[model samples]
Target: MTSTPPTRRREWLAPAGLIALSLVPVLSGAARLTQLSTGATITADNARFFDSPVPIVVHIVGSSVFLVLGALQFAPSLRRRRWHRIAGRVVAPAGLLAALSALWMTIFYEMPASVTGPGLSALRIVLATVMAGAIVAAFLAIRRGDVRTHSAWMTRAYAIGLGAGTQVLTFVPYTLAFGAPGPVLHTVLMAAGWGINLLVAEIVIRRRARAMSARRGRPAPASVVSAPLS
Candidate 1:
C-alpha cells in the first residue's frame, strides 16, 4: 500500500479546518448579528447599525454559496474543455453576485461609526473589489485559454471570500488563550482571518509560478531509442 503524500496531507488540513470553523457559529447558538468586543457584550441597541437581519442573511448566504462553488472548481474532472467553459459561465456570475452582496451588506450593516469605522469599511470595500476583479479576470483568462492565469486569479478571489471562515476559526483559539474580551477579540480575529488569507494567496501564487516555470523548462519527451544491430 502506498502512503499518502505529504502535500495531500497538508491540503486536507485547510479544508478540515474550514469545515470545523464553518460549524462554529451554528454550534455556539450565538445570534448571527451579535458583535462582541473583548468579553463585554455590546447590546444590539448600542450597535444599531447591525440590527438589520436582511444584510446579515445576505452576507451569510452569499459567502456560503461562494465557498461551495469555489470548492467545486478544484474538481479535476471539470477540467475538460466543455465542462470548464460551462462551469466558468456559472462561476463568473455567482462570484459577482456573492461579492456584490457581501460588499453591500458590509456597508449597510456591520460598519461602526467611530474613527475605525470608516477605515474598516474601506478595507472591506477594497477586499470585495479585489475579489470581484479577481473573479472577472479569472473568467476572462479562461475564455482566452489562459488556464494558468485563470487558476491564479480564481484562487486569490476564493481565498479572500473564505477569509471570514478563517477569522472565526482563529478567534476561538485566541480568545481562549488570551482571555480577551469579545470586541477586541472579534477585531483581532477578523484581522487575522484576512491576513491568513492573503498569506495563503501569496504562497499559492509563488508555488504556481514555480510549477509553471518548471513545466516550461522541461524537455519534450524524446522518442525511445533501441539498439539497432546487436
Candidate 2:
C-alpha cells in the first residue's frame, strides 16, 4: 500500500469533480467557435464576444488543458512512473497563458453578462497576478528539485484557474431562483468563486498533510506539493 504523503484517490476525486463542473463553461466556449465557423448571425453578447474573443478563447482552451491534465497528475501509478513531471511541463505554461489572457480580457474587453466596475476590475487584476505568481513559483520550485513547494504552489494556481468551475456552483443557483444577477451580485458571486476554490485547496492541502503524518508516522513536508486537485 502507498504511504499517505499524497494518497492518489482522495486527491483525484476533487479534481474529477472540478473537471466535470468545468465542462459547462468548456462546452459553451466551444460553441462559440462553432458559431464563428458557420457564419451564424452574431448579435447581442455574441457580437461583443467576437469583437475581442482571442483572449477568452485562449483562456478557455488553456484552462481546459491545465485543469484536466493537472488532475491526472494525482494518479499514483502515473506519478510514480514520472508522467506527472511530463504533464507538469505542459500544464505550467498553459496555466500562465490562461492567466495572461484573463488579465488582457479583464483590462480591455468588457464582458456583457457581467460587470467590470472598479471593485471587480481590481479583484480580477489581483487574482490574475496571484495566479501568475503561483505558476512561476511552481515552475521555479520544481527546477530546484523542490517537489513539495512545487505541488503547493501549483495547487494554488490550479485553484484560481478552477474558479470558472466553482462559479457555476456558487452563482447559478441565484439565476435559477430569481433571474439574471445584477452587476453587484455578479461581482460578489464571482469573487466568492475564487475565494471558495482557494479555501478548498487549503483544506485539501491540510487534510493530506495530516493523513501523511498518520501514515508515515511523521508530518508531510511543510510545503509539499499538493495533490492535483488544483
The best candidate in terms of TM-score: 2
- How close is every model to the real structure, measured as TM-score? 0.67, 0.83
Scanning candidate 2 in windows of ten residues, the lowest lDDT window is: 221-230
Query: Which pairs of residues clash in candidate 2, taking residues 3 or more apart in a chain or in different chains?
Result: 148-225, 151-225, 151-226, 152-225
- Which lDDT tens digits does candidate 2 get at residues 145-219? 876677678778988888877888877898999887878888888899999989877876677567767887986
For model 1, the run of ten residues with the poorest summed lDDT: 221-230
Which stretches of model 2 miss by more than 4 angstroms?
1-12, 113-118, 212-230
Q: After superposition, how far is residue 104 of candidate 1 from its true place, in Å?
A: 1.0
lDDT of 1 by residue, 12-129 (tens): 5655555555454333323443443233455644353334556555555556656665565554444544775666676667677778876886666644433132246667778888
Off by over 4 Å in 1: 1-56, 75-85, 110-118, 181-185, 218-230
lDDT of 1 at 153: 79
Distance from true location, Cα of 40 in model 2, Å: 3.0
